[model samples]
Target: MNAWSNDGLWLAGIAAVAGLTASAASLGWLFSRNRYRAAVPDSSYPPEVLESLYHHSPIAFALIDRQGRFLDINRDPADMIGYGKHEVSGKPFLSLIAEDMQEAVRGLFLRALQGEQISQEIKVKHKQGHAIDLFIQTSPLIRRGRTIGILAFIQDFSERRRSLERIRYMAYYDDMTGLPNRQYFKKRLEEKLASARMRGSMLAVCYIDVDQFKLVNASFGRDFGDMLLLQIAERLSRSLSEPGDLARMEGDEFAACLDNLSSAEEAQERLQEILSVLKEPFELRGVPVHITVSIGVACSGGEDDAATLLKRADTALHRMKENGKNGYLQHSEDMDHVAMEKLTIQHEMRRALENKEFVLYYQPQYDLASGQIVGMEALIRWMHPERGMIFPGDFIPAAEESGLIAPLGEWVIEEACRQNKAWQDEGLLRIPVSVNLSFRQFTEKNLTSKISGILEKTGLHPRYLELEITESMTMDVERASQDLRELTEMGLHISIDDFGTGYSSFHYLKTLPIGRLKIDRSFVRDIKQDPSDAAIVAAIISMAHKLQMQVVAEGVETKDQVHFLRSHRCDEMQGYFGSPPLSSNSAHALLMEKVNRPALPAYH
Candidate 1:
């Protein structure tokens, strides 16, 4: 059938598939009238009997003359069109259908009058003035083998049409985010690709995955996670300026196809704009949390298929993850090699855990006033059997990408505590040992119990165990505050690391049970060259003291930095200026020599 043909079912409603050919009852009804009859009237029923049956029937019925005029509309049909029977007796049948469908209705009625009975679904303007889907059946009336008029029946199909529309909507849309689902997105992407090809225009495909999104869900809760996804979807949908579609592919993963780009740089600029927008903090359930998205982009090649383009984008996204996330990367042929290496690192890190190949190196923190070392922050080192020694910066990202951070973080805690106990047993200084915790560790439901178990197993006093978390960890103000309180009650100190580079408010910093703040190394690296760095460090020290919280200046490698921190009365300091991260034995040698070295170059 032609596209415009309405012969078959429209929405699978109750119409009984009835034929619209002239029926004997319809012929009798048309001929019941004496004046307008083209032939003899049926004696079985008078015009009054036919009128009563037609008016009382539930089905909306109308009679039209050969010219498609509404010769008569029964009470029910007239009510369907917001009119009295007397008001529409001579009006055209097209007046009842929607304005756009009036011409089509005229054509259909003309065909019926010419002996072509028609059954179809159409939309009509209802009595309440709203559009409604209706199943319409028209039968031609004949008397003395001459056609005079027709009988029309209409049944409401609005409810059935709505149900079918809802089903189709769910099939093509993401329920959590309301963006297009992956399957529907593929169709849209292909269409865009074809348009780009036709115009010889560039296209860019971006694959975005929230960095550690599962951790956000697990830590804050599933409810907040869903809310976060919804907000992200809404923002991303509005972010597109070019013709595109943003689709939710799976948990924490979304993709987009951008076409009609003048150049690849345009796509990059647009994508960076998206990252900037997400950098703004999201407030969910009265708690503000920061989120970062890692994006991988691929510009169209002279010839590229959807599979190839999408795979390239995904490969770039993996590269972003391996290269320390929270950044974007354009796809390149060389990235595939990096992707394979990441896979290898993931396998090796897991195996390294079983082989006990991971080691902890300690860096000493010293009191600025006394010139005496206070404690050591434990940093992980991977002594890969084949690659020799691998730093945390090299393999930690791969471990995180592979979902190995939970086990790796727990191991660090256990090992650091055990080593601290071992040092105390060897008649060394019993300074508190701090271990960095990843976002993943924060999400562990039994994190408190797990830490308690580690302390028990290592026989280390809780007073000597410290956990260092980034400022980002505390962005969820309520959750982070409660967690910090619990950890403090358990006798373990918590330090907010990388203090100035996150979205946490000062209120949380002053109110939470955080024991200390570590001035980020970036600010310290340029303390002498940049006056702003010195001022920031001074301000941080003053604020920490005002709150009765200790301050630790990290990466303080210069004597000038040391003098600056001492003048500012910073509480504690760590960097190469004191000493680099040392092996366990080296750290113990410094720990055993616990004497307060006086008359220092800066401290004195």
Candidate 2:
């Protein structure tokens, strides 16, 4: 009975404790819910959230009056403007804006107060007198369903705007010369064209290229070349004081747009002045280095646009190069036709390789002393399917410009080798076959490999293959020397063609692995008539003999030319008089007959 009573008392005590715990838990829950609700203000909701319901509470906010005066400002607004609450309570918002933008600020505030939203780029002055570019958005502040003040959101955009301006300048200006570049030039040219069309004024475009600049760069190094170019830019800038635009089109090339030109002659005179100024020597690294320029001038016609004008200028520049460097040429209808023809030729040449439209003509080279054939030069001719035969003069330069010379050169080498091997197989004694290498081919990285591969494929001895490179082609001495060494090691013969035409540095010639020097046809053609030509030819032949190198006279068209070359002990001769370039079969027959014929009597 005692144990039962104790158990029942314990249970009753436990029940009483549980009932108190439940009441306490319920009160605590109610207190926490109320505390949470109180901690968060009703106005804590975002503007987007509050717009869905009517809620009001105190927070930092601003309200500008219709006249741009502060009707009501919160503590945050005063902090934002670096002012006390009372200081901005009734102050005009325009007072905080930059002086130059006060009227704009007033107008924006008025628009917002009139029930319109305003967004604008503006400047605001800080208490320190510094102006900040700002993006501001103002909305109407409504009370009792009537607009009374404005609420604005501001952001700083000074850095972003400045960055954009910098990018704009970079896009339109040449970083090196600080002049308007091609992009800016084109933009200005378009504007000028539009104005000129209305005013019936004329404009001219001139393209200028530094003559023999590659030679300077090759000889003096690129740093000196850059210095030279900078000097050129300065001189060019000084040369033009007229209202015109100048731009560096590319490396060692520049263009100018001359607006309000009265006539082509005036444009020509201006270009001449520019060219004359450019001709002056530039002091680079304390050394005065002279440079010449070629100018191409084009004037705007009724049908011309900016692109057409530039094209015309380019065409004129090409004509200047063709006519000989260091002069100016004006664009004409004839130039346009030539440009179109070149375009057509370039397009057709792309197909020439695929169509196998090229043929090899051999010009026999004679031993001047023996009057016997020693070798032949392989000349390329384009057998245009529809246009008949086209001389190299018509299309070789075009091929070079289009970067097709390398492949075309490979074709020439392979064909020449094959023909030479064929002649050898026909019991004709093997003779060296020389092929003129274009400047593009000589500079190609794969030149040696291409020649070696062709010789190996055709089973022709490398000694029987001679490469004739001009003096200008060897400007890159180190590279050319390396290439020449590699070629000579493979048993191929190398000769410097047109010896006196370019800046022939005898010092460099001695270093090259060369076997012969071919006097230029220009010197040899008039050797019999002009003492100057004779003297040059004689000097060249004499120099070649002293250097233990052979000399070949080209363009020996008359008996007198032949006699003079013989007197000079010239080693070989090739020209129209000996025989023009002949077909492959005829060349083979001639070679056989010459080798078999009795030697001519020595000149008495």
Candidate 3:
């Protein structure tokens, strides 16, 4: 028989395989009504060629009899269910479908028999009884103006379905710790919030921060840091009983949404238990390392939304850290006031930088032996137009948190260098101006280049500029050593500020090419009264002198404290005892007096 002539099966099969909207039933009616002389196109292939394509096509094709039994199926569709063409030729087509979906599949087949095209996704049973997803499209095969069979085009959909599942998993989960990410957590929080609101129940949201995790990351290596994070995640997972309630919000930070809470007190009790469990030391690389967390919790109120509740918890966390870490704090109204003040300050700092409202106040550093002003530290002050001068303590923490410190620090260095050069141009005695470097500025990449550019732009000699870094910057000793070495090579001076207040490792201290150490005010304030502070001051001064580094005592107010520092051979002192941080013009006047007078100022 000629496949492409008379029967019209070739057109039906081709249209079904090509997924065209033109069904064989409608086409057969059109041809019969028109009595088309060109029923088979002149360009139609030979009968054998059409038959070969029907059996060998990669696409799964099937012909079903009016009884819904498989009349003929291509190799691909047979292989889809682990069967061969000969084996399934006489079997009922619905037997290949999963039992639960067989009725739905039969309805669709009946609709196709009624001259309606059917397309749907259904699960079919393989030879091994496992389900395989398939996208099947069926069309009624019309012969001589009546339906004889159904043509189906089947496509394996299991791979695409599995791929979509993997994509969803990645989107909702943290790849490193395998916990819910911030987006997923937020979604869950919203769901829980809706449920709690409906039931007149309360829930709690918590924001947790790992104390000093950055220091640990710097001290150990990133690989070890990752291991520590994984351990922390596991511990948190074990602590929380509810699945999907806990999430890794960010680096060293986690959040939890606690539902089914009877009262805020219950949430607190549960958090306390978690804290107790965390008290046990974590074993990483066979070493027991102690870690602590600071958590902030906010219980849901009658009108709380997810974002508002989360912010409240974060505010509480900040309060916990401010009050000192290794503890937790409950969100209160007062904390919001504090958080608002901080936000206002941060906003003002941005404007202050843009408007040049931030000014440098110079505090004179006196040489203890020579009674002469040698250097001065640059202190930042916000000269608010209406509020007078706003101090560092009021705004610095906000700037640090808001990521405004890097640009502010750069401005400070540039302004200090420019002022120092201006003083030199006016014939004032040459004195190095020291600028404190914030942690963000110190750790930023290409810091040496930044400083070098500032010096070149201001036309100031590098020797007359000093950069002060805190002891925390030295926690990564090797990197610190290399960074400091680069600065020294450019002839810039380096000083360790607030030396005893941070990770004070004497062994790490000896490796850097630091020129000065400033003893913290806490020690110097009680140096004469407290024996331990006195001993610490004495040791710091002695050790600094031994290492050929100059010591500067901070906050030296009383004459007795200055006398003690002088007796200890402290190289310099800067505090109210000498003079409080001065304006640029005042500092220049004092320098001029030192150059003209035989005797220095009163305190000296």
Candidate 4:
């Protein structure tokens, strides 16, 4: 015989004895593995085979009587509950389940005893009093359609459950600050925006940037910076009202959304409170540090979306930073227009560089005494195919903000050097050409080397390529002096542009290797009318001469202004009175005229 008979009492006896690992195929098969309708004593499998299956099966197996008492259990099931098979035998099946879950498990046991198969997740109790998550499948053991016992297959689920929880946390939370991260914040803001649109209620989104956060990180080390950020997050979270959500958007920046506001003013009031609270000092490792934030807020309107609202808030924040940080601003329609224009300019400037839409315009600088062109200053103009000629004022600020100044400045330098060499090669006068340098470009580590390479590539003498740096670039005199000395050592002329307008230190001026100072146009524009302006220009010229540096007056428009500068002994001047910035081709013709003049006055 190969199998047990399909009889109730005979099958129940085998199930209780063997703890069968396989799931029930039929009601009788669950209890005794019966398929052939043979007697139990005549089964083909040996007792040793059944014992090995019961002990070594990966899935936990348990057999319980109709009364819900443990009839027998396999080694896996016994180990899962921290018990020996003998200890569990004859005990109530609910004894191994968590106390709070036993009643629900009891209902499942009863259902299984009624010849139904079931699968469920449940919590079980281990011998050490910890809860273990488990998944179980139960089937009834029956004979002749009468239920006799329940057979269960069990598996541990705790590890997988923990993995899911960790994944959720990582997705929704910032591990460093314990605040919701950008992804979570953006999702939540979108939901709030939708709700506000439906209810016609007011909401505000605030974008915040920590002012001088880079300085903090640099001075205090990253560990202290991390601690400070945590403190800041905690304060921001606490200060925010119940109807609002705060999130860490990125390094040194946070985002918040306020809901259920009565009006835009109400949102502003709430945000102001948050700002006030953050003004308090934070202590890290027994040292106190004070920090301020700039905030930009946008209130919900009739049809605001998340992207538009965030962009408006971010734009407001940017303006606040520009106006000087440690303050907040609300978005206005005007700001949107300005932002869009700025964006368009930024986008076009990059394309302008790539497509050669940018061209150099040379404004001739003449010797005040000789009435002759001594040199020319190279200026950049963006000839946008669509917008026509765009002056530096309209696009230079955008370039500085977008970090396009580095490449833009490099191009101007190389082009000026190349043009000067081209003029000299054409048998024209070899006059030096000056190009203005942005402060950011002036501070570049490779500034000197970059200029040297340009001179070499253009085949222009270093002395014929003058670099103009503004006074603001000289605030860090030590560093500026180092770079300036390097350029001067390479035989390039160095001049300070808009000289007296910035915070200049006369003490450091003597030590720098500067050859010339360009008086700010602001002082010269009103010198003919404003007596103070005339005095300022005169003093500046005298100071330059005393320091053994030549002076050039900018914006010399009228003849009276020209005579004043010449009387002050200013070495050179450039303005519309001489010529406005001219295109390269026009400047080349002008230079040729100068070279061809029968008696060109000697250039100073």
Best by lDDT: 3
lDDT of 1 by residue, 1-604 (tens): 1111111111011122223244634443334344223443446434444445544656666667777777654453553556677766777767778998888888898888777768888888876888988888887766567776776777778888998888987988888777888888777888888888899899888999998888888888999898899888878877886433799989889998877799877887888778877977899777888999999998888778787888899999977887899988999989878778889899888889999999999999988888777888999999987879899989888888788999999999999999999988987777899999999999777889999999999999999999999887887788888887888998999998988988857888877898899999999999889999889999999998999999999998988888888888988899998889999988877776654553245465
> Compared to the true structure, candidate 4 yields what TM-score?
0.87
RMSD of each: 10.7, 12.7, 4.4, 4.5
Per-residue lDDT of model 3, residues 1-604, tens digit only = 2122432544444454555435565655533313333555535545555556665556766778889887766564555778777778778989889999999999999999998888799999998889999998877777687887787888899999999988998999998999999889989899999999899899999898999998778878778888898888888888787869899888899998778889878988889877887888887668788999999999998878888899999999989999999999999999999888888888888988989999999998888777778888999999998899999998888889999999999999999999999999999978899999999998888999999999999999999999999988998888999999999999999999998999998877789999999999999999888999999999999999999999999998888997888888888898997888989888878888777442333344
Model 3 vs. true fold: TM: 0.82
* Candidate 1 pairs with clashing backbones: none
User: For model 3, how many clashes?
Assistant: 0
Task: Report the lDDT of model 2 for residue 457.
Answer: 98
Better of 1 and 2 by TM-score: 2
TM, every model: 0.58, 0.78, 0.82, 0.87
Relative to the true structure, candidate 3 has a C-alpha RMSD (angstroms) of: 4.4
> Over the full model, what C-alpha lDDT does candidate 3 score relative to the true structure?
0.84
lDDT scores of the candidates, listed in order: 0.80, 0.77, 0.84, 0.82
Order of models, best lDDT first: 3, 4, 1, 2
Candidate 2: RMSD to truth: 12.7
Candidate 4: C-alpha lDDT: 0.82
Give the per-residue lDDT digits (tens) of candidate 4, residues 55-84.
666666667778778766555355577877
Candidate 4, RMSD to the unseen true structure: 4.5
Could you tell me which residue pairs clash in candidate 2?
A: none
